[model samples]
Target: MTDSGIPVVFIHGLWLHASSWAPWLELFRENGYQPLAPGWPGIPDTVELARADPESIADKGIDDVTRHYAAVIDTLPRKPIIIGHSFGGMIAEKLLGENEGVAAIAIDAAQIKGVLPVPLSSLRATLPVFKNPANRHRAVSLTAEEFRYSFGNAVSPEESDELHRQWTIPAPGKPLFEAATANFSPHSPAAVHTENEERGPLLLIMGGQDHTVPEVITKSTLKQYRGSSAVTDLVEFPDRGHSLTVDSGWRAVADACLDWLRKQNL
Candidate 1:
């Protein structure tokens, strides 16, 4: 943000802790950037703690979650560049809108929910949890099989299974409910109130094979923000899925952002 040091932050999606961003944080550090990855409210910092009890904080909402990260960003030495995946991507976009210094990259992001283009894949990906109204106050864990279909579709079965074992934690259902039931109103929980021109160089990346946040969502979001003067770029990776940031070929995506950073002279 100040151009005084490396500026990069990684935000993980639902069912994942900040540690999931560790791989990318290391990559960014190697490329001469400072990295910050923080977790949501009441979320344990370690995977062991998260696995030990998934129901501890199953009712957290988007605003509460956003405020937690807002506090984290407040402590930063400067307005760090942000990179987020899935739900985290949504929060990053909100942060970009709220803070003038935020530069952002959203990967496989799901915008508020009522953007008029719900691809069948996107619906199917979220169906496991959203099919029931009771999920709102509960925590949802991905079955190995379900995780494979929604997230690991980009990789091998074995690799996907292992990543599933290592990364996912139970996620609060309230955020999804709010996103799904965003009320089609300008004043809503899912409303990010973003100004495309106010955001710094931003990028939105999508997975070609992703079911959770399909390519159409990225395209539509770009179209909505096309009027902004800020640089906005959309990129799609062949066969990638919602778990693009955590999978084996994640480096390519991260490197792409790094290349974009060079182009922006950030």
Candidate 2:
């Protein structure tokens, strides 16, 4: 924790580690904001370490994972401006749902409870997991073509390949499955936001070309979020996919976030 009261906490989604926010860290720091990105429980301190032994990430479930982040926040002096991608975004919402004083930005957040209407694109994104139950503990890498299709469709071919090489890794199958079957669960993971009316300063960034969390899905989230006192903000970046955070034009998106933050004085 810095001398500054509450800083911006960047939470990375499954597969990629906290380092995925390196570029955004630079921009956020330049704007007088602090950046903190934490790893999932038992996750290696570095990317190389995690890639070498994917089996170490096996036992984390939604409850365990959410509690770990809550513990991290407990140590902070003030509530943070939580920015998350994919599953991390969902986790951010869950964190704010139970605890107040958080401002959040969910970038192409994976589907949560009330945010229904899963698209074929979302299911297709998880197709590799359906291959085997044992893969939950393994580190899987997406092929260039698969990465391009699932996350970087809007970026150039070379950029898409580079993005895949730089980030994409095997994520736990359990979380994906948990999110897929959230509606069926008695304790739905997606219900975090819809269940909390006091969630503060929420923003939903949807990629126009995103297949995973498509426009329809985001619309559903916006509709549910509209009922809250939290100042809801929505931004749609055209020609981007799920990889909007790491794609070549990632700075544009980051700038948009900062622009919003400046308005809110975060």
Candidate 3:
């Protein structure tokens, strides 16, 4: 098929499905862009089904998720402009390293190999899944309390409750373990090719109050891209948390992204 428009793909992080990108899809489409958001392989079609069979996500690794998204990108007529959050963001970076996209944005991206900073809040946020070694092979779901702490601390209690009730689902455990042990594993899937000269222009967006992937985490990822000739920029929202993409103020984040794309002449 001939490429019809500037294709934009949105990749959601853990605990949420591709449906989380619904609003953004509408927004991007209204702006004359063709947007597609594909979930990790085997993800259920609805939030209820996903929550019902949470364990279905167990044992999925980074390579599996990356390959699924890469295959989707390959179907596009031209390289896409990819955007991702948390683990999804890391996958976007990995794809960009392979020169699979035209440009990319990573929002509150999970730490990949060579990103050494580990903040207290990040550890606390991740402890729910990583504290237990058994969880590495299990699909883990977060409690409302844990979700509030990790994703919605900056939002209202009611909003936090709704976010947990609606979008939260079980996430695979293997990728978390892989990322946690990336430094020790020579063949870690958490690794990314940061120095690839062919990498398209990239941007990293951070939510200042985000506990799961904090400023340090995103900054460390940016630091890893220092030697790259491709453009890499970082933007922070001081009052936002990890849920910035889904919170009430999500449009502000979207606007920033659209603005960045415009600047890139995309």
Candidate 4:
């Protein structure tokens, strides 16, 4: 079957290898869209290799990652529908606001500059990296227990361990540092053009139980887009956590996305 000519790009957040989007790619492809999942700059092609050489992905900040994905979008035949998780979701919003994508779905996205509420759970979820300032220029890996707390808390212990073993990878700490200090910086990379009225539609999905980016943060992110006249919507999965994109219930989230795209006639 021929593709619908519309592209769908999946952006995986930190701690998970880009291959985590494999199922999403297949699903979107079967639904008539051309889908691609590209890794961050310097990310190895495999989880094992990425785990082995964390330095390759170290020290990459938000701007660096955003530019990398923007370059990928430039290579596509049409402006793609961007779907991103965690920091990738932040990148998706930035890209969409800049007109790089036709539309975007930001699921459990990191807090942008204007987002003021930093829940205690969020602080705890990121403590592994924030505990040490020097980590900003390094790569950080989460232990299985930490992964369970931050990404898999809403799922079973066995499934969390399996997910940690299957897709976990060291992630750059620079972006976290940048996002943490966004409000203090005069020109922060974590700042999104939420007021871009000419930008494409946006969807913000929140995992109500997400420790890393709690529900309040997503709600704050929604408020950030209030100045814009563009399409902006929010959905909450109250029982889900940060692992929603790769968990057993991922299909439900993907199907919701597909339904939204169809509604937009994308």
Q: Against the true structure, whose TM-score is highest?
A: 4
Clashing pairs in 1: none
Give TM-scores for every candidate, taking all chains together and pairing residue i with residue i. Answer: 0.94, 0.93, 0.98, 0.98
Report the poorest 10 consecutive residues by lDDT, candidate 2.
133-142
Per-residue C-alpha lDDT of model 4 across residues 178-246, encoded as one tens digit per residue: 999999998999999999999999999999899999999999999999999999999899999999999
User: Candidate 2 vs candidate 4: which has greater lDDT?
Assistant: 4
Output candidate 4 Cα RMSD.
Answer: 1.2
What C-alpha lDDT values do all the predictions have?
0.80, 0.78, 0.92, 0.95
Weakest lDDT window of 10 consecutive positions for candidate 4: 1-10
Rank candidates by lDDT, best first. 4, 3, 1, 2
Clashing residue pair totals per candidate (backbone < 3 A): 0, 4, 0, 0
RMSD of 3: 1.1
Cα RMSD of all models vs. native, in order, equals 2.0, 1.8, 1.1, 1.2
| lDDT by residue (tens digit), candidate 3, 1-266 | 33667999899998877898899999998987899988788788888898899777888999999999999988988899999999999999999999999999999999999999889998899898888899988889999999999999999989998998889889998898899999999999999999998889999999999999989889889999998889999999999999999989999999999999999998
Error of 4 at 46 (Å): 0.5
lDDT winner, 1 or 2: 1
